[model samples]
Target: MSNIINREIKEIIAYGTSTNPKISLSEDQAFNVLLLQYYCFKESDISKVWYEILSMITDGKDDGGIDAIYFDEEDSKIIILQNKYSNAIQVQDVVNEINKIIATMNDFKEAHTGSYNKKTKRLLQESLDRLTDENEGNVEILFSSLATIDIHKIKSKLLGIEDRVAYITVLNKGNIEEMIEKLQLQHEVVAEDSLYIDNTKNVLKYASDQHKGIFVNVSSESISRLYNKYNQKGLFNLNIRRYIRNKNVDDGIKNTLDNNRDEFWFLNNGLTIACTDFVEDGNKIRLYNFSIVNGGQTTNLIGEYKGKNRDEFYIPCKIVSSVDEVSSQDTMKFFNTIAEATNSQKPIQPKDLKSNSPEMRSLQTLLLKHRVFLEIKRGEKTAKDINIKIKNDELAQLIFSFVNQKPGTSRSNKNSLFNNNKFYKQIFFKRYSSEVEKTEFLLDLIELNDRYNTLQKKFKAELSDQFNLEQANIFNNGKFVLFALFGLSYRIINEDVEISSLKSNSSLIEDDDFIYGPFISNYKEDDIEQKLKDLITFFVNILDEEYTNQYENKKVTSVSNFFKTDKKYINDILKTTVNKLGRTYLYKEFLEYGQIFKRK
Candidate 1:
């Protein structure tokens, strides 16, 4: 029904069908390929994109009602796609496909794997295994079509499915059109009138390496008008924290404006804007292609208190425009650096400033040698070579676990821990002369923890009779168990006689010495694998004992609340458990017996 969407879809189909001469793809098959291109982007390397798309497509005669599938790792949600390319698609047809996908997901493991092609079968099995092992039940069933279906009728037919899934999204012709529009916006040239600031005063100038900086004070009314014009668009596009309503910081900004308007400049950190080009005329400056990389909260709060405050308040702003012609990548790096440096003065996490660091680049390059991807920036593109990538938040968790020896704290307070000044200072400020060695060790430790997590999930699934593992409780706190394992590894690395000898022999343990030395010597391949299994089993037993004690005594009110709110209580528990199991019991078991705990 949508002419724009139909035109684009037809173009894609024509290109796909014409390009592949050997294989005679059906219209439906070509449609599936177009859908893959639409979501993944055709500009990506063909071999890499095709390899991924081939694994997702199962549109043959005995297909399991799923045309394509994508797992969003960052959001922990599975997107099961059902494509109807025809313009005559109906409500009943769409409802039937939705039901089929739901049935397939419900008994995915027991489905007829032979019906699917080799690639589809392998992908399905792996995806289902990961979902079950990680306990990621959130799903999104997207029914996309070229035709416009009756929204009310479709909703009536798919009544209870919403309750089953996290949510169902219908990507009709309009949705596809919007996606195309957004993609086009990314490549479009900026217009002259796109950027505007009003009533500027007392403009002064300075210079940086390749940028000219202008400092000015603008009336609060003009700032409010500027914010109102570009409220939720791309004004503060580079700000780490977007405008969050009713936050304590927002309240504080409002209070300062209301009570002490004269001291506003002293109270606030001011705004930093980055522009590709700008024009100055007396007290008014018109920026071009500008983004507010800092002071997002101040901007939003000014807009919030626009009418309440008298016209006496003034806001300080710094506009840094590129003076020298540079490549887009270099410009991006420059603005990102400016945002990072300016925001360091405010309360922010280390990860927020980590993207532009030399250490991050070094780690990224080092990890690439091992076919690992280190994502220093949020929403950065993944490498085509590696399937697994580690983001900043995950890296922060690993650092917290290693430095603090409290995995529970890292897991429960993951967001808050990154913002904690003490934790951030401890991790980032340390010397990394042995960057590669420490990175390799940390990567292995992360893999080990992942294995422990998988085992915990399997155990919980098998023993569902005792208590609901999905429920938030101390007994089901997998992070606590993971921290215990980290504690054990910490002690082993620091105190093991073999590890000490290896450390003495080399400046630091060589990659090869990990096989025979103290740090991971016992953990070499099969030996370490079996020891991890036994360690998880022992911890499960300890968890059972703790659960029984808590149930009988009713000492804790809510396990989730206790772990999240009371850091001292969780840290105390971690210390007591590590002292008893990790230092005394598990330490002796690992050193003397190696994998002997399996027999016990």
Candidate 2:
């Protein structure tokens, strides 16, 4: 193998060993993981865990020459992968593998009793059954070899088999190398110091105090080439809804480029670019540090297009930039404003607009030290060092649901949490005196939320009693409320805190050492989960008592309705429980509940 491929293989092995040391695999198995990770599942929303990927391997005896098989639920497709971990693979080997898969698919379709392993048959049968006409089930055959092979030759050999498969992708060493190169580019920002814009058409220029722009018709082929080179490298960083794939829209764009070239300029909305500056030469214009803030879908379609008449058409283009020599606070804000105003094809939420705000960027920087990634852009790449990818809206929801103690609003008014200036500032505008302390406090909330979700899933799957099942339903619906209650329980245990103290701005809440140090930080994951389960049991009983009281007075109808209404009544119940039972007695009750569940 070449040095680069060898290095990649070694890295994959190292990562697998590091991430999951209990399970081990050979180099061939590791290579399969690498290929599937980057090629089949990277773009699609599939599990990227090493152990999960390895679990899909059915490559033992009677495997039918297929290495790994996965059902991509996001795209509703079946992926059949065969990897060749070698530097010199024969063309016949590729053909034999494809033929084997074709036979296997036939077996699946006919329910034939084949010699394939039971695991492979079961997986393939189930996956094939999901691909009906209503959902447009697709089967993707990926034949990847470490050696350089003639893909066109292999494709030509499979000519009449298009009816059996949706599409076949054959990748050789060169293709893998190209994929690796693009993967590397996803980690870094790529800015073109100078790009030539076609100036053959009428170039309308406008100049303001600090803004400069041009309206022109740039060739689609040029845009396509630039997109091909810089698409993964921050080409659409400024785009609010970056490159959502709609098959119908994509086919329309490609069809027009292929057949209706003359009407392309009139049919589609032009691209809107934000740049640092631009200069016009004789027949070309040069743009620096530019990003496509609009027309992300059109640009992506054209970039990956295979139409022959791609170069025969031009797209309407509008490029805007600032004249400031140095990037200032005002200049960056200007760029953000332009990005917000130009995106109109897809509905832009208020949170989407705040992705580039100073507060968001500051929080992102603060969290990076703790290995938490704040994904602001729609499809931005997560850096290599990131341990977690929290979307901006997710953070907003978390803060509102847990810290602010408004679980109902967190669920129903999520957009308002970002849309209302006061709410947005309340959640994100805090300047942490100590970043590490603040991060740990927030991380604990995330941990609690995760444990709550896991227990909910267990209740859904394992519990059988009608009352418990009804409670589980309430648990699922009022998850955010339960999340807030968990935090409230912790605060109550630490001190005689009131309900209003759960607000994010409360000094008692901000004092992480005082609030989180003694109890939550002292438990292992198993212990935390047990404590959370017990807390939920105790809270459920309290909620029942409060609901019965209110129902007798004709104030509330049901338990779920009791949890769903305004949080004030819920807080009053919690306060009454803490005051009636006393913090010490309630703490003992939590422990007793834990012991009961443990015994069960």
Candidate 3:
């Protein structure tokens, strides 16, 4: 082995034996041999690089065609990479890549110009007044197997097309016989040549030290297998690596995962959430107003899509509790949360990137989490340092809301204005029916306050009917038999405005098509009075699934059962309201019901 390769091997062995070095190399000895060799390319250097890897995408997430781009600045054009610890390289993976080189050259030629081949050219460079092929420099040398590659083979095999692309190789052989023949016996250079048969045994010893012996060879072999075994055991211990990014998510779900790391995945059921509370495990992650199973949710706060890929911009999810294991349908089930992570405005739902399920989405959330944990000793008191990786993997999914400046996905700037004049009577706007603009989507929030004289009269009149009235209502309106029919709708309580129509907001917002984003359409009621029923059910279902799981996961069955009781809490909870934008509200007391029972 060359001196450089020997040094690299030393580092690999040191990685294991060093104080607490991250000894991650597999037990596969051959794999290590190839990696170390690859690291010894003539220009190779492994100094300090990145601090953390946040948003890592091996499969061109950014539309950049490179595999595994890191956040580090390459000190030189030469790059040194370490791949699988067990790969064995062959010859023709070489042929395929070589084909890519040939194809690139062909593309360069095909994109010709002016009178030369006007119609045939794909790219016309007007600046040069010629073709794009002339400007797209060269393919340059993308050397493989820096150390073990026989330099002679490169100099001989198809080494054509210079200035455009080049292939170079490095070697690591020591010819003792040829070396002795070349040394000249000069006065100063060879004066101390007292041959005492002094180095035959030492050479054998040097060839076998754990680090020095196998390092270069192992590292070398691995790089050669790049094209041959790129799909095999990759680098890392995470879930996204095994799922979405890797799986070819074609029409029908392709097996995108490498199927190599299954232990990191399993069935988790703890997914119920209400307002603030979720299942509490030591590993759960907490965001503003919500929680997610640690590493389960990714929030793109701005929602404007600062990320390069749609996958990076996940629907900001936070775990409400610990993962549960329930027998749901045929599969085990759990509730995964769609957090209330909003921008400056209303909260958004997890993007319907696809669909929700008993397993898929929850797994996606866990795969994208950023884990931060602390470890302590078995018996010692508090005294220790910390372990953190280089933050190279930053999140790519950026979030923004509907009230933003413009649609980023389009070239023509589409301003962020709703369709109604109040909503904006533009292209997508229209008139809404009384049924669609009913009690759920409120305009003003403080409608039922003590200062509103009409509130007292209306409350009394509404509460006079069949009774689901609270105990407090009985005390206030018992004076008249006609005062017991108050049915407080969330929209009325929140004081949402009632527009006769929304013909100005949505093109389809006809005199009767009630548009409430997509939520209210779930229950298309005929009468405006009946829509309140759907609003009540929406709240009940949102709470029934979310918060109840948190209550149950802790084995705190009491809170779960407490919800069934007809107590003061029910009246307090019922008094809660939401605006059309889904903002929560508190009535008499300042402590809102959603906030109060969130943990329950």
Best lDDT among the predictions, by candidate number: 2
Over the stretch 173-286, how does candidate 1's per-residue lDDT look in tens digits?
765665554444432222233323344445788987878988777667767777776644456656644443333455577778878888888888888888787777755677
Model 3, residue 339: C-alpha shift (Å): 54
Q: List the residue pairs that clash in candidate 1.
A: 499-518
Tens digit of per-residue lDDT, candidate 3, span 1-600: 344434544654554444235544333332233333222221122222111110121221222121221211111121112222212333434334444434533553464222323211211111111112322231222323323334345444544633243222222222211111122110011111011111223221112221111001011112122212221122100112111111111111111112211211221111211122122222222222221122211111111112232221111122222233223321101122122221112212222211243222332222223221111111112222322211100100000011111112111111222111232222112221232332222111111111123433444334333223222222231111111001122223223323122112321111222223222223333432223322323444433343335334632222212232222122222222222223333222222221211110
Q: Please, what is the TM-score per model?
A: 0.45, 0.51, 0.20
lDDT of 2 by residue, 274-356 (tens): 88887777557677777888998888878766546635577888989886676555555776688777774454668788988
Instruction: Show the lowest summed lDDT stretch of 10 residues, model 3.
Output: 392-401
TM-score of 1: 0.45
RMSD of each: 13.6, 13.7, 29.1
- Candidate 3 to truth, TM: 0.20
- Cα distance off (Å), candidate 2, residue 572: 42
Judged by TM-score, which candidate is best? 2
Global lDDT of each candidate: 0.58, 0.66, 0.23
